[model samples]
Target chain A: MSLHHQIRQYLLDQAQMHGWLAHAKIPSERELQTKFHASRITIRDGLTKLESQGFIYRVNRKGWFISPPRLLWDPCHRVNFYQQARDQGMQPETEVVSVNPLYDAPLIRHQFGMDYGNNLELLRLRRLDGRPVMVERIYLRQTDFPGLAQQPLDGSITELFANKYQVQINHESSHILVCGTQSEEAALLGIPEGTACLHIERKRYDANDRLVDYNLEYWRQDALELKVSSRK
Target chain B: MSLHHQIRQYLLDQAQMHGWLAHAKIPSERELQTKFHASRITIRDGLTKLESQGFIYRVNRKGWFISPPRLLWDPCHRVNFYQQARDQGMQPETEVVSVNPLYDAPLIRHQFGMDYGNNLELLRLRRLDGRPVMVERIYLRQTDFPGLAQQPLDGSITELFANKYQVQINHESSHILVCGTQSEEAALLGIPEGTACLHIERKRYDANDRLVDYNLEYWRQDALELKVSSRK
Candidate 1:
């Protein structure tokens, strides 16, 4: 085996044995180089390998740190963002980016089985513990919920719908794909372009089986873990 | 907006209106350039933008083609490999890369509540319609199903377990994350290193609520779409 590979294995063993907590800083490259008696390039290669494998991440010049524990989410549960984060012992915050009336959006019209009028679009940026993790774009049919555009758009939409509109979300159909983040999303999340992300498209329905909202969520890849329990 | 952006929008409109089927070849670069009276660089830039958005892909010397329709998969469904592929109108094939007895797998032993000495590892490469889609690594306890390592490793392990040991999987717990593909998995899937992929870790249990197997699956990003239905 190569020197870097051997060094990587050693670091991995150390991480496992010491129970290196999330966000803990690993040894500096210089320290690792001196300890292994290896060249700078070898040490860098080893660290890069570890980073790509999800063991560590670099924060510009801040050096390498153990990756944070991913937020465990169960999409099947009707829990809102606030409850989900609180359940995992993390602070959650939401910033409403923009809210505008949309007209003549063919896709949104088709999804809600309406034609060309009275739609509201809401864009929000969500963070966990002050780290931006997801960007959400939601479209709602205005005719179904009069004056929805006037309501405060921050915080949990699910709770807002239930409290004000008395519309309980009964079902959700979601599709998930992995892709490179676009420039706009990258800028919002403070990540580089082409960073891998999970793109989720969902159609939410009310208790009457009406398509109430269509949502698109772009999530940072390393920050979340989607959990599902299957029954046979 | 830039000229390339305008051109990309026009092409997108065309794709949606004309029902451009998946895997169909789009107009060549020369054709696009001539039609738009644009330079080679401008046309290439627009095409590259589309490719990165998952609208199309390049096949080396074969030019660009529309990306194939992603296979819609519901992980909660108790469907085997063969049934899942056929349900999506595709052929499925599996090759057993290797199988061996594992004695000192600390994690596996801990999960199965065993000390050591009786574990089996199986590695498989799976394809849909002749295109590599996923690589799976499964670890099973030998004491639970004696002679498991000696059984035929090809085809569906779900069926094999039923017929050989009468062990029906009753529940599965899964965790999903998105990350850049590793070198070994990239090579097997015929994709470039560091390509985005969905990594799923699953724990399978039998009717008695005993842990039976642990599996890790790496799936190509563009080849599959995970679907989930949440009921409230």
Candidate 2:
């Protein structure tokens, strides 16, 4: 292996073992170049590869810092984000931000097949590990919950659907896209304005194949990734 | 329904029917306000909601544009980009750009258990419709196909594996993540620098569970979306 590669691996292993990826800082390119007797280009190349592979991130003109490994999600299966995190041995928690009843607008009414003036409850929260990664705002039919917003605001939304409402979430279809963060989203995600984000709009259908909830999740681009596979 | 919402639906319908997504300009905020006969605040609210929901993208100086839809993919099943596009009723094509034989690096060699100096043939291409959308580079064991680089590289990679190498791709694993386009990537995908992309690295295994091929695919973000379901 090349000296530059050797140094890169050494830094990666140290960071991984330290368990301080979210804030661990590594040596500067000049420092690495001097220590390894390598060219600046070689050091930069090693760092570039590591950054592209989701190992670390750069802030401004400052040197690199170890970034937390992204959560890998299998897109082919019907798994939600919280469960996927737990399955990968990470703690999943949701903080309820607010809940309110909203009246149906024409566009939302059309999408949800609700009549005019039909009231729906909107539940908003930030889902996180020990730290926040994504913000979720869910809109559900009020008739299905029958005062769900008044209940406890913690715990899994899926469990709330099953145990409290007796609704089985059989399947859901999600649409994922990328966009620059907006002011509201940026404030919630704690990222800068115009930082890229993975936006997911999901309409979940119940066992009877009825659209039960419309949920939106905005994921921090540097922190999470979704993976999917298909049969050849 | 509120007048503002009625206007929102009208704009969305126009966007959908005309495919007026990202890069395609829309009526100005002032024009929308005049046409909808709604207050500027109301129009701004609707536009803000659309932008927040990923249905539109806004520029600092420029106004909003309809957001492009992403290609939804299921990762658990083995499916290719071509198939995913076809399922969405869109035309898809793959162009073979280059093929060559090269030495396998230590990482590559260890991953595939290959010997040093063993030549590995790689086929590189850009998958496109009327324009390039994804770049796929596939590497194979040279001994499996002595003349693969010289053969006419068309059709599916799986078919090539089956017909020439007599290998059945029975199973595979894939890793997906986000990537920012590099210079070479930009030249191939015909996109500007800093374009967000989906990076998928996959290794296919044969029926005997032996690794046969390793592929790296960079998909244009505007062209694809992924969906995963969560079972509660």
Model 2 agreement with the true structure over A104-218: per-residue lDDT tens digits = 3565566677433455645454544554567777877677788787777676777778888788877777777666566666666565454556777888887787888887777
Candidate number with greatest DockQ: 1
Worst 10 residues of 1 chain B by lDDT: B52-61
Error of 2 at A89 (Å): 6.1
The list of candidate 1 runs beyond 4 A from truth reads A1-67, A115-117, B1-67, B115-117, B180-183, B192-195
TM-scores for chain B, listed for all candidates: 0.76, 0.67
Distance from true location, Cα of B131 in model 2, Å: 3.1
Segments in model 2 whose C-alpha atoms lie over 4 Å from true places:
A1-20, A25-66, A75-91, A114-123, A127-130, A229-232, B1-91, B113-123, B127-130, B163-166, B190-195, B227-232
By summed lDDT, the worst window of 10 consecutive residues in model 2 chain B runs over B121-130
lDDT of 1 by residue, A66-122 (tens): 777678898887578888898889889999988888876787778878344678888
Tens-place lDDT digits, model 2, residues B137-225: 77777777777777767667787778877888887777767776665666676654444567778888887777888887887665567
TM-score of each: 0.77, 0.67
What is candidate 1's TM-score for chain B alone?
0.76
lDDT by residue for model 1 (B51-152), tens: 545666655456777777777888887577788778878888998888878867787778877435578888899987777778888998777678776888
True contacts kept of each: 0.68, 0.49
